[model samples]
Target chain A: MTSTTCREAMREAIREAMLADDRVFLMGEDVGAYGGCFAVSKGLLDEFGPDRIRDTPLSESAFVGAGIGAAIAGLRPIVEIMTVNFSLLALDQILNNAATLRHMSGGQVGVPLVIRMTTGGGRQLAAQHSHSLEGWYGHIPGITVLVPATVDDFRGMLAPALADPDPVLIFEHALLYNAEGELSAGSIPPIDRAVVRRSGRDVTIVTYGGSLAKCLVAADQLAGRGIDAEVIDLRSLRPLDDATLLDSVARTHRAVVVDEGWRSGSISAEVSARITEHAFFDLDAPVLRVCCAEVPLPYAKHLEDAALPSVERVVAAVDEVVNVRA
Target chain B: MTTVASPVPATLAPSDVELLRRMLLVRRFEERCAELYSASRIRGFLHLYIGEEAVAVGVGAALEDGDNVVATYREHGHALVRGVPAGAVMAEMFGKVEGCSRGRGGSMHLFSVDHRFYGGHGIVAGGLPVALGLALADRMRGVPRVTACFFGEGAVAEGEFHETMNLAALWTVPMLFCCENNLYAMGTALARSESDTDLTVKAASYGMPAWSVDGMDVIAVREATRRAALQARAGGGPVFLELRTYRFRAHSMYDPELYRSKDEVAVWRERDPIDAIARRLTGAALLDADALEALDAAAMEEVDAAVAFADAGTDEPLSDLTRHVYADRRGERGPEEERT
Candidate 1:
């Protein structure tokens, strides 16, 4: 096993994809000499040269649309949007072109483009930069949405996304960039399944992206209080692994969905509805949810911490589902 | 507006009658489409490319094999000139399985990767960046391919148009930005929308060479586009051409013609591209009245056959509604293979 941070894993994935395919190139706001806005592409320009590691103008729509066009032509372009909030500038290209080109063209065109962006609230970046809108992207049809919370996923998800025939949007949680973890040798996880991080039988703590780490902490706290929580890290967000989620919920008979996005119309809401739809009879208690408050993520550290899904919030939700009287 | 008067060389020029026949085909095909829309045989939006036929045919004649074309929703003419079979394009409008985009694109989104026709993009200025990218890919591979993007002057108001121009100019990508300045954008006129009425001026502000041509004149469009394309292929970077023309029909099937004066339409119709070419051909004694009638008859016959083909075409299966959403990754025939 090799230890690495999310930043290193992301950079490594780009390097590997570039080394493998001549068509694969990276383009974004400050991806070259400036070393990327988040420093994920640091040193890639020197390693891959300016052609592969391109630094584009601050025009999001043009760059993103160009990426889609390149993907349509013959190249596999990995476009970094700096952050999920800034991706709104390129939302037209992402929604109208990238997501709809293949189907709209009646299968004639396939945009094998990878759009990586930072998501979630933790740093004091405030409302503009801190919204976890990967759920918004999950609503798209032609695009594959992936949330890589682990070091392995951060390292491995990009290659498959690049290889896929359709466009893929990867939401790398802003707070998890420095989240150091060990990646197993030659053991890359698939992009379509939700894995059981901590298997148990009392409750299924379902979460993805930044909230996975918080839910794991909540699970550890629950175990101390005589409750065994099965933590399921949802790596794939778009085609949600309903079978694994339903199976875990059936075994545990309880679930508490954790999401960093706002509760209403959030991915957490979708997962909760799915469990209720499929595993309604199997549930011993009503499904609970721990999500960020409906208000826009605040700039103050205390308010931002409160507005986001925390370990304490997850623990309380888990406790509520577990200790409920039948 | 500064107009360039470069004579199109005889060797590279298409026969005068051939250009007229191409335009006649588009006119007849779209007229049939209008009739089909009225008869309920064609559903959804139908934007006719009647008056703007010369821009597509002229520009299309200048393009060499393996070149890319990115067009707007009013793309029936562009699709036909780019070599997407009339039958397949008609079938697409009919939403049949045999259509260019397998009937999924309908009227506004005709696509054929085999012909390198990217799409009939619905959004204004959306195809510009895609065209830039196609050129960028070719430029990176050292392939001397020029991507010609067709959009209305209204797209100039969009940020993507400016952004794409800057990028294509900055990167020195081989691209031909063909602006069909057809007076009105849906209902809004160019004077009502753009601060500068001159479309070529907007393109020139990006430091790219730009020109204003008489779009109603097919020879002018062909010559200008040919020169621009040759320059781009010769490492002269991207160039823009504003084809000053007018659409004979309403924006779409549902428009009530509430925008412009009928007199203005009449004035523009006096300079009809088809009539202008037919007059020139007849005046030159190269095309007789019988020959012109024969050409028109041939176009109608082609349109009739296309309609028959569309009528005979089958519908895409209901089960396959979600088929190409992610593209089939299973078989050996993948998206990569299709591009190659």
Candidate 2:
């Protein structure tokens, strides 16, 4: 196992995809000479040159639509929006063109494009740069939404996304770029399933993206408190792996969904609703959620931390569900 | 405004006659569509290309096979001129499974991949960026081809128009930006909507060669598009042609057209493109009154056959309603084959 940062792993993944297919190219603002907004594409410009590694102007709609057009014209383009907030500027193209073109064209055209954007709050980037809106994209039917929490997933998700023959949006947590983890040499995991990061019997702590690491820490903290919690990282958000989630909930009989997005109309709400819809009889306690406060993330470190989901919040949520039955 | 006598070719060529026939086809087909809409045979929004036939036909004459074309919602004329079968277009308007988009997209979303006609995009200024990318793809692949994008002058008021223009110019991609300036954008006149009225000046600001042509004259539009398209296809970067035209009909079936006056419409109608071309052809002794009548009958016959085909077309089954949302790539290959 090679220890690498999530940023390095992502850079390596893009580099590898470029090497694998001549049709694959990277386009975004500051991706080439600037080495990506988060330094995820450092040194790629020199390796791949400007033809493959392109730096675009701050025109998200144009470049994203261009990516869709290039995908239709038979090129695999990886369009990187600097942040999730800016994706709103191109939301028209994403929804009207990228998401609807295949069905609109009656399956004659499929957008094989990958759009990667930084998401979530923690480092005090303020309201505009730090909202977890992956759920909004997950609600879309035509595009696939992926949130790669681990270094391995950050490295592995691109290949499958590029090969999927439809538009795939990868939401990389801005806070997880510097997180270090072991890069396993195993085969890349399928982008359609969820995996149990840590197994337990007391309760299932469901989460994804930036919240996964916090959930893992909460599980360890819960273990010391004699409350064993199973941690499930929802790698894919749109096609939420219901089987994995329901099976774990069936055994545990309790769930605490943690998400960085707002509580109302969020992915956590969707997950909790799905659990109640299918596995309501098996649950001993109500499904709880540890989501961000319904406010724009502040710039202050303490306020930002308070707005986002934390390990303490996860631990407390699990305790609430675990104690309900005790 | 008075109609200026356009310089007609001394002798009409066979290609020029074909251009006039194609324009007549568009005019007749849309006239029949208006009647069908009134008869409740074709529902939903119908935007007629009544007086703007010269733009589509003249521009289409400049394009070759294998080149890409992206157009806006008022795209029946574009699709017909691009060689999408009249039956397919009519069936699409009828929302049948045999339509070009398999009845998925109605009047505003006709698509024909076989003809390389990308879409009939509903959003204003939406197709420009996509066209830029299409050209970018060909440029990256070292292929010499041009992607022609058709949008109304209203699209210039959109940010996408500016953004796409800059990107296409910066990338030096082969793109032909065809702006059909129909004097009014929906109900808003160009003067009321845009601060500066000259669209060619707006395009020229992006460092691309821009031209404005008399859209009512089919030969003028054809010559201008041919020059611009040849330059773009020869890797001369992007070129913009503002086809100065007018829509003689209301914007859509729903419009009362309170924005413009009947006198203005009558004035523009004096320079009717089909009538002008027919006059030129008759003056040159290429088309007699009987021959013109024959061409008109043939167009009506084709429209009749298309309407019949649409009438007999089948509706898509309810069971397959959710198909093509995402491509069904299941059972094709395992994830193992996708690994690097």
Candidate 2 CAPRI category: medium
Candidate 2: stretches off by over 4 Å: B1-11, B330-340
Candidate 1's residue-wise lDDT over B1-340, tens digit each?
5445454544322377899999999999999999999999999999998898889999998999789999999999999999999999999999999999998888999999999999999999998989989999988888999999999999999999999999999999999999999989899998999988977777888999888888998888898888999999988899989888999889999999999989998999898999988887787777889999999999999999999999999988777777778777656544332210
Candidate with maximal DockQ: 1
lDDT of 2 by residue, B1-340 (tens): 1122233433567558888789888999999999999998889889999999999998898898889999999999999999999999999888899999998988898899999999999999999999999999999998888899999999999999999999999999999999999989899999999988888778888999888889988888887788887888888899888888999999999999999999999999999999999998887778889988999999999999999999999999877777788877556533221210
Clashes by residue pair, model 2: none
Residue A199 lDDT (model 1): 97
How far in Å is the alpha carbon of B264 misplaced in model 1? 0.5
Clashing pairs in 1: none
lDDT of 1 by residue, A54-113 (tens): 999999999999999888888999999988988998999999999898888988898999
Residue A212 in candidate 2, Cα distance off native in Å: 0.4
What C-alpha RMSD separates each model from the true structure? 2.7, 3.1
lDDT of 1 at B185: 87
TM-score of 2: 0.97
List the candidates' TM-scores in order: 0.97, 0.97
What does the lDDT read for residue B203 in candidate 1?
82
